[model samples]
Target: MASQNRPLSPHLQVYKPQLTSVMSIMHRATGIALAVGTLLLVFWLIAAATGERTFGDIQAFNASLIGKLLLFGWSFALFYHLCNGIRHLFWDAGKGFGLEAAYRNGRLVVVASIALTVLSWVWGYASMGAL
Candidate 1:
């Protein structure tokens, strides 16, 4: 039989998602994505060291539509993680703990991440003469 005097734990179904909670979850997810994306970096480096044929093959694949999409996703994850990490540093310094402050900072992180990602891709393409 359930105890009538004990307090019940809050269930996720009954909780309304807030920006702080959503950002916390996203921070964890982006961290994992960054780790997986590092493998692609390692592969590119190994291909370059092996020989021209191997490097060329990797380049060709990376230039494809799907590969571009993956690259964009990786870049976005990188920027998001970077921005959120900065927010964490502010928290470590004992700041921005207010509810409104947290929400505002969360929004800033999202905007900064998107802006940084777009700027990075634009610069990359421009340097490659694609822009």
Candidate 2:
């Protein structure tokens, strides 16, 4: 029989949030966001094939404030996912195992993802003559 006074395992409340833990959680969240974003992409493609009215409606929505916000968020998620996936690849190859190295890489992932997203959006707008 187990002791009633003692818990079987440490609960989440007992632990402080660390960079690795936060990054891991974000990695999973971005993955889910990417799936949802992919659905949006599919919807756009379907609208394109459906008719001009349908496609125009989709385009109009994409040009709206809320839609742009969602698209920006999705782009961030995409870049974040890509950066973190690369970090995982490095880990799988037995690199960045130290605590300091892990933290450094985690910070790099965040910075790189943000930079890439912003650069892509800027380039996109400039190409579209919207800049």
Candidate 3:
């Protein structure tokens, strides 16, 4: 009897990351981030219902630098998830199946998400007179 070495499957280290794969991974990640961000939304709502003091405390925290950063990240994740989800809808409709179209739409999703996120933040700050 004899044992033989066998070839193993290619993995992260063996293969370079591609745009499609990276976008797919990011879609799942942003989905999870949105779910977590929803919890913060619920907390804020509850604080509002509880009392002015509690709501004010929440507002104060949200006005802080760290809180602002988290909100910014959550907003970006929301936009990214939304744009990627729309891309998935097109895929489900049997569109953008070609490699070139897939690549083009993938870039479109990234650009649109970033643009929307920036625009929303700018609008928010402007409305609040913080800009």
Candidate 4:
């Protein structure tokens, strides 16, 4: 008979999404974000190496509200990717593979990323005499 009595293994919708899953996906997404954001970093470095006018222009753009917002997002993404990367390294070393461990580590990464981002921005603003 060609009738199916049961579904096959590894069905895509079998498992519902969770915070840990969402964080994992976001981690990867932020990785791409940071990679793309690096174009500006490269430009900044090159401009610095070139001349004051070029560097001043770069700084001006980066100091604008929209530019600050973009860089803020970039900073968050960078920290998120970094924290998640460290978590992955633990996995690579055969740690935090259990479900409970995975969940905890995922939370740790997200929290640590947010904390780091806030700290960085705080320091940046302080240096700018804004705080």
Highest TM-score model number: 3
Clashes by residue pair, model 3: none
Q: Report the Cα lDDT for candidate 1.
A: 0.94
- Compared with the true structure, the alpha-carbon lDDT of candidate 3 equals 0.93
Badly placed stretches (over 4 Å) of model 4 are 1-15
The reply for model 2, stretches above 4 Å from the true place, is 1-10
Worst 10 residues of 3 by lDDT: 1-10
Cα RMSD of all models vs. native, in order, equals: 3.6, 2.9, 3.7, 4.6
lDDT of 4 at 65: 95
In model 4, the clashing pairs are none
All models: lDDT? 0.94, 0.94, 0.93, 0.90
Error of 4 at 83 (Å): 0.4
Q: Which sections of candidate 1 miss by over 4 Å?
A: 1-10
TM-score of 3: 0.90
**How many residue pairs clash (N, CA or C atoms closer than 3 angstroms) in each of the candidate models, in the order given?**
0, 0, 0, 0
lDDT string, candidate 1, 6-91, tens digits: 87786657879988988998999999999999999999999999999999999998899999999999999999999999999999
Better of 3 and 4 by TM-score: 3
Clash list (residue pairs), candidate 1: none
Q: Kindly provide the TM-score of model 4 when superposed on the true structure, using C-alpha atoms.
A: 0.86
